[model samples]
Target: MRTSPFGRTALSFGFFLLPLFCRGSHSARNQTANVTLDASFVVVEEYAFGIQGVWVQHREPTNCTQSPEKPRTRDITPAQCNRTCFPGSFQPPRLSDCNKIIESLLNNNTGSLQANPHTWVYVYYESCVAVFENPDEDSPTLQYNWAVLGANVKSLVNSCLSTPDQNSIGGACVFDEYDGKQLSNVEVAVQRFTDFDDDHDDDE
Candidate 1:
């Protein structure tokens, strides 16, 4: 599948993620708005169906993890297995939204996100659109070029509680010189939660 440039723009900042529709998912555009957005954000609306006024293959949502296909090839970090649970990549976390994926499919309101585990998908909701009114609310942060994402997942996600310090868990993404300073910064954030456990807090 050709990844959208709009998607590139949205995630380039490590924020503002959007989703793209696949090619087989397009048919004809129904009704849409003409909202000029940055090239990066535009990919958020790019779909097989084309942009607004273009065709959109209609179907309900599908389970992103329903398939057994070995999930998208992912690069794991050395620190990956160090902790019992790593924070999930996506935010506003909702497994039920995947259920909504099924609902949208059944209603034929929009095309489903065909994916297996490890592949993160997102779509804008009607309510969200009512606010921004932009068609690119559905963000597929996982669809980002594997190379960039792989790198971020490895280093960017390295926030862990520090050793020796009872309060800090934020650590450098890897075993690098930078880890010490970031660990120091966390000493400040820990002030908020006196009992906060950066990695795994054991106590009162």
Candidate 2:
């Protein structure tokens, strides 16, 4: 894996300062690109369970590369990630009305609550929609269930109800736990690759 210039610094100090920076930005509705998808995901995840700070990450196709080997891991604010490869749009509700929006989005799918077609990058949500949209695929692992959305909503609500004070919602609390878990795993893998490359250069 290839590491961007921001990776090492991020590994050094990003996690510790995350909450502070996140708190500074109440909403990403108008912010250009100072927040990253990963960080914004954290902010939105927190907001879902009634925590504050909602940040969104918007990226153009050119901001990210499709290749897995040359992954872009940056420590800078989302605005500075000119060459970062991870791309997506993440919109979270404001802190004041997060609960209301969450409730509506999860419980009342009155066509008004449809996921953003252009921004719905999370695979689990897409897969659930796909199972409904394309019955001909005959996906063995994912059966077509009309109650899929309800089930996910129930699970997320239960998680929030169980632990409202937990600063970070664990894996089970997310719309799709796998998305966070997979992203985390990829970050770790990228870090290890960076370490290996550094060691190799030192030896040479």
Candidate 3:
């Protein structure tokens, strides 16, 4: 999704235009990415929910060249990455920050897993996100947002919502447990998609 020069220039002028996540209940409208502008800068409604993030891909690597007398390496240096986002796709914010954060999360023993295009990254600051009915207190309703620069991250999102996947991945990562871990397997994912409502928060 390459942004037109006009779009980039416009979004850049208002890059900090963050959106708001709904308070009190589960408003999928809270899942919207709204943008306008104040007299001086662009304005965007930020949501810990929509902007919370998932992954660039979910497919596993199909091949790995073996190392002589050693276990094959899991190094995921972007230069050596086998898969990539569609040409011209522009992840929001900065792709550099996403790479750094995702790379940090992919280090052996820590971080989430990345099987080629199926790269996984974690939510930052998250003072802006939420889980269930609770919103982060530090970041208010909006602040920072994390973006993945690739394909469908629905399964990854579900992993984050699920129990053991994220826990198994980053149970000891840090104090920010939920954001750091994967959101798959969550019991409350809306398979029967419908209008957002207060009751939705407790569907799980």
Candidate 4:
């Protein structure tokens, strides 16, 4: 049986995290009293049946013996985890609407939205609709060439916030992020919830 790209990525990630997990376990064992570790956040890429989507996992803190061997993770709902969770204040784009857009793109049924034959699109939580040029035939591998589509982000958020009916939002929008550069891999683009500071001046 062939391993899917998603499986391969997960296996690799697991291997990369083995040492960290070991260290965490060791530390837990040595603690005199039960110690609670900080919660971890990750953006997971899920691909199955040739369809890809992203979701956020908020791993709750673990207290050595009180918690199970594996830390518990809570899958954050799109509504709860959005731009509002970040430092900068902005109305977050509705993830349900973004899901519709991704579905349309995957089914090749985008009505007004035109994506290049060589481009692939997916949503990065409530942040933005990420677009990337399909890797060349020579590469044939899906590279992490994704970049945020500013125009699409604006349109989607505006539509979701202003329009009462979400059913009409997906097909009516246009997607154009061809010139976008400074791409990053979807896997490494994980958002850290613990890194935000109340006094920080930077805005998203």
Candidate 5:
């Protein structure tokens, strides 16, 4: 299936992250506003999604006595592993409002907010990365095809996070280092999570 520019598989995920493009900050826009953000007081722990959106490093189970260099792959029936989990399938942290998150960031003027672009990109991508669990939606192939998913995520990041020109909403957003083969290593790593046997035949 052709995915959305935001890599959300044409699902609700696109809608969920929609506010990213709206405006910088209402406080920043309104000159008379009395609000001021204190980045120093902002606790990293308060950002539940940011802290939890981590990928668990894969390890061979102790039950497996064999060489981990040649790990086993699942031949799960369609009924068992019926669906692939899109990034949207996994529950986002207790974050009920993206606006609140934005407002909080806007208010912060201390050390925490110093790395704006890097911070923005980091949390944004990690929120999506949190959905990399095994798929719950049915797929003809295994859900962990790193090439496919990584490519899709990259597309989504570019589509959703990039800033657009104010006068031309449809015009291209500014390009960055995220383009091209940047996801190659990610794809290679994700291949380990799937049952993709290139030589296996239908008869096998």
Candidate 6:
């Protein structure tokens, strides 16, 4: 699940480009390291969903001993982590579009979640990408995209649509709740699968 250099470069470029329209402040530029970008999967004319994020890996110390000479404590950081989602493998569902949808709704003064209770949101992988979708029947569509450095097309169906096993990459699902703190026991099964740029205003 190594991230391709092309993907990394595209993501890095996307990071710097996002700040211009996002916050339009000096802080936004410096905050790229922690920034999360929203994107969608495009599936013909029916559905397009994706996640809004950057796959970030934070290092933690290990508990394994480096050598017998020192007899010191070491830590084995699991290569797999919940915070990090890699391409080509369905890591556990680490990203969600619930907040993004909520934010979009609020920005347009779309009232509250209670007003529109029939909601479904999720994050899935397609053609190596981790996509999240929340379609709006009431409004015109908007386009937001991000490049996933290590996306792959393996098990795109099982991970997203079929009943996944212990090793499957099926996405995480959330419902009407804006915070999405309470997760549904049943993950949303998608029947189909398919599917950014930035300018620093005056700068590149």
| Model 1 lDDT tens row, 1-204 | 212212223322323332333323432322242223222221212332222222211221222223334333211212121211122232211222222222332344222233222222222221111000112213211112222222322232223222222222211222111212211100000001111122433332
Please report how far candidate 3 places residue 69 from its true position, in Å.
41
lDDT of each: 0.22, 0.21, 0.21, 0.26, 0.22, 0.23
Per-model TM-score on C-alpha atoms: 0.20, 0.25, 0.18, 0.21, 0.21, 0.19
Error of 4 at 100 (Å): 17
After TM-score superposition, the amount by which residue 66's alpha carbon in candidate 2 deviates from its true location, in angstroms, is 9.9
Give the winner by TM-score: 5 or 6: 5
Residue 131 accuracy (lDDT) in model 1: 8
Best by TM-score: 2
Higher-TM-score candidate of 4 and 6: 4
- 195, model 3: CA deviation in Å? 17
Tens-place lDDT per residue, model 4, 1-204, is 211111223323321121011112222221221222223312112222113334212121121122224332211111111221111123333455354434434443212222221123233333323332221112122322112233333444454433544322121122122233221221111212111222333243
> What does candidate 6's lDDT look like per residue over 89-118, in tens digits?
322222232233222322433111111111
Give the range where candidate 4 is weakest over 10 consecutive residues by summed lDDT. 76-85
Better of 1 and 4 by TM-score: 4
RMSD of each: 17.4, 17.6, 19.9, 18.1, 20.4, 21.5
- C-alpha RMSD between model 2 and the true structure: 17.6
Better of 2 and 5 by TM-score: 2
Order of models, best TM-score first: 2, 4, 5, 1, 6, 3
State in Å the error of residue 179, model 3: 31
On TM-score, the stronger of 1 and 3 is 1
TM-score of 2: 0.25
Off by over 4 Å in 4: 1-121, 126-148, 169-204
Q: Which ten residues in a row have the lowest lDDT in candidate 2?
A: 126-135
- Across 78-133, the per-residue lDDT of candidate 3 in tens digits comes to 21111111112221222232233333233322322322111111233211111111
